[model samples]
Target chain A: MNSAALPGFDDILAAAARIAPHAHATPVLRSRSIDAIAGCSLHFKAEPLQRAGAFKFRGACNAVWSLDAATAARGVVTHSSGNHGGALALAARTRSIPCHVVVPENAVAAKIAAIEAYGATVHRCAPTIAAREAACARVQVETGAELVHPYADPRVIAGQGTATLELLNVAGPLDAVVVPVGGGGLASGTAIAAHALAAECQVWGAEPSGAADTFESLRRGEHVTDFVPDTICDGLRGTLGAPGFALLRAHAVKVLTVDDADTVTAMRLLWQRMKLLVEPSSAIALAMVLGHRQRFAGKRVGVILSGGNVDLDALPW
Target chain B: MNSAALPGFDDILAAAARIAPHAHATPVLRSRSIDAIAGCSLHFKAEPLQRAGAFKFRGACNAVWSLDAATAARGVVTHSSGNHGGALALAARTRSIPCHVVVPENAVAAKIAAIEAYGATVHRCAPTIAAREAACARVQVETGAELVHPYADPRVIAGQGTATLELLNVAGPLDAVVVPVGGGGLASGTAIAAHALAAECQVWGAEPSGAADTFESLRRGEHVTDFVPDTICDGLRGTLGAPGFALLRAHAVKVLTVDDADTVTAMRLLWQRMKLLVEPSSAIALAMVLGHRQRFAGKRVGVILSGGNVDLDALPW
Candidate 1:
């Protein structure tokens, strides 16, 4: 696959079939109180309940499985200090393949423990992109492992699209689908699935205001990745991937930015009202829906809760 | 129905049909990590996802719907300060009937708000059982409403059993089923359903060590409700009802007592590992199983996560 090529809807379908045995067909949950507050019928695609407690599992599982047997036998390597690393590690375990994760030295011990718990080798480096990438490269060479880019890879993008495909298939006809934008894999893939399967269904991306590189890039009609993230959404601080940017732009996906305060409030509401313990990154989707009630009023909106991995001791509220 | 009479398996089946439209057939969730920890195949009946965020909704809905049109029209009244109050209120709203909740003066403000949010009339009284009963009686007399006792009512017991019924129907055959013993509605109902459907499956009750009235009652072969509850499980502080005791004793249900610390540990594990934010009251079931792993080893155990109604600001751990 070309480095900058975006995965198509057909690729998403293939990814869905490939990961059917591994990934969970997470339930779509509804909250009446949240609907009343937002003035819209919201169908929540509960990816928080996915394997590894995030939608990242879909993409990681697909990437791990898409490799040829020879390459798969050599194992897979990724650099992530968040859900994708654990997701990839778990995906590798499903196939009984060796996995290596390049983690930042400053990464939370709990997150590193979680990745290790999934039976992955954790290689820690200094807390910088250069250090992380070099660590990942070293691991690939050392173990003859295949390098699986977390979001930029086409296989991962197609896997991410599977969640939206399932959502559309189960949620009937939705007026719109909103997904949180981090490295843009989920948002772009969601756009592809929603456009191909339900053309009339508008696709929107929710990003944290403090880490709105994707939002800025779309606004400027170019790539923008110089901003420092100050948001509480740890999983959403990455710059938008090149392929993800291309797909999202081509699909004309709308981007909505929400403040961290609003995301925290939405997170609390999800916990208190919907009984869902989602992280700030996942809650940003709900924040977008609630903040833009006028635009979504009386419409059926599907919001993907991206993940539920949170440090319970350090809750935002 | 006699006040001390136990509900039969037939009543549970009828209740299942009666409340099918109102109550959710909650999903049975499984966690590989949790299963590995206990050395048992655990099927967690996710009642925390049930309507009103607890299995209480099942029984409450059944009770409201079981009433005759004229009696239901007069409405239903209950004295509760927790999930049952909110559940009854929501259940009554389903029937568009007037519901009165006699909440104690010291009830959590959030609990009161939850009940009021469901359109139930809140009547505050002193924090004594006598005062709560008096307030319920006043409401019953003033509005000619039917009194819906929290647990003692046969209709409610039958309704609570529907959760286990659905669990048994979907989870195949289980070696045992563990339920938290609160006012005993869930435990007694579970025993009735488990014995009738899977006669070989053992039924066990988990209770807070500080509120082990049910445990003591079973040990002494009589009712025991003199001790005050000191545990953090607010929902399990209630004394076991007469009907619940009679049913539990007749079914030979065994009770297991767990410390509050163990319940908190299990609660955190559920939230962190399984991504399920269950209350300590519900976590007690997992605590019971983990505490007695040898008894359940190599067996399929169904654990009911009773509810997810917790004060986020006041998590034990």
Candidate 2:
């Protein structure tokens, strides 16, 4: 499979099989109280309970295992100080492969500690995109390890799609599926899987209004990267990836933007009512569902709870 | 069949069969990261994710459904401002029967709202125990509803035991099972189930140091009820009921008491590491396991996460 090409249903299918032994088949949960509030039957794909505490494990596990023996022996590298970094490191450990993470110097201490805890070597660069990329490139050149771009890589996107594939299979049929859009990897993968398996299932992206690049890009018919994100959702701050954008565009996926305040409210609701400790990024999907009741009223909706990694001391509420 | 008698393994089996259709058979989850910290393989029976957000649902469901057609039609009543009231209300809703809760006026509005949301009529009384009991008795007389004691009744204890019964079935064999001793319903039931199913399996009760009634009772060879509770584990503050004390004493169950500080820390760890939003009461079991590593080291320990109903605004940490 080409690394730069957009991932399709076949790629997702292959990725699912590849990561089956490594990634968790997370449960699809429901909350009647939450369902009543949204006026829709909700099937929440609980990836918060996934290995490494997020759905990122699916893609990371896929990418790590998809490598050839010689390539895998060389190890894998990525530039992330969040769930993806932790996930990739944990995935590499399963295969006894070395993992390198080029993290920003200003990354959260806890997140960096988590990456290190997973037995990954963390190389800190200046807290700038260019410096981070240069450090990653340097690591790749020096270690001869394959670079796994968090969401931009075809394999990663395909891996992320497996979550939706499992969700669709477990949830039966759904009128629509709502997934939180970060760099659009999950959204893109979800679109591919839903389109192939449930043609009638409409795919929707829930984006934080503070970082609505995907929504803006779709509205303008092009990728946008000019805005700075100021939302409480730390994971959804990344600009839209090109492969993810292309796939989402091809599938005509709708984007729903939600306020961070509303995301916090939804997050609290999830915690208080459903007993789920989902992050703001994940809760944003539910926020979108509740915010737009008319679009999903009385319908069976599948919601992808993207992750559960949160700073206990720095809660938005 | 005798409400006053201590429930046996047979009663638990009956409860398991009775509540199978109404209650959730919650998953037994494992966290490798958490296991590494505790130096033991921990199988967490997640009752926090149970219907009505606690193991109380099992007992409540069993009691509500155990009623004959005429008795059930008359409705069921309980006096609680916590999980049991909500669980009983929800259980009654499943049978489409009227339910009444006698709650103190000083009870948390959120909890009262939850019980009401489950379609139970809330009967408010003064904050004193006598007043609450009087009010509950009045409701029993007025509505002709059967009284379902929170943890003392045989049917309730039998119902609570079903969680451990399911845990053993899913988790296979375990060296021991740790359960929080609130009113002792869950603890009593757990002891019966574990002793009957796996006679070699030891049963340990985790109680808050501030509310160490069960520990004191066991130490003194009699029930204790003189201490003023001061723990963050609100659910474990109740005086151990006579039936529960007798059952625990007969089973020779050991009780481990944990400080509120340690319980808060454990709760935070559960939320952060496992993505499980367990209350301090639920987390006490893990606290006991971690605190007494020597006892549980290298052993397979089953920890019942008693409940997940928590006040987000009033997080102990």
* Tens-place lDDT digits, model 2, residues B143-254: 8999999998999999999999999999999999999988898999999999998899999999988888889999999788788888888788788999999999999999
Tens digit per residue, CA lDDT, model 2, A1-317: 87877788899999989999888899899998899999999999999989988999999999999899999999999999689999999999999999999999988999999999989999999988899999999999999999999999999999999999999899999999999998999999999999999898999999998999999999999899889998889999999999988989999999989999999999999998778889998999999999999999999999999999998988754
Could you give the C-alpha RMSD of every candidate to the true structure, in order shown?
A: 1.4, 1.4
Q: What is the lDDT of candidate 1?
A: 0.92
In the order shown, the candidates' DockQ scores are 0.66, 0.76
Residue by residue across A1-317, what tens digits does model 1's lDDT show?
Answer: 54356789889999999999999999898988888899999999988899999999999999889888998999999999899999999999999999999999998889999999999999999999999999988998898998888899999999999999899889999999999999999988899999998889999999999999999999999999798988999999999989878988999999989999999989988987777779999999999998988999999999999999998877865
Candidate 2 root-mean-square deviation in Å: 1.4
Clashing pairs in 2: none
Residue pairs clashing in model 1 are none
Alpha-carbon deviation at B233 in model 1, angstroms: 0.6
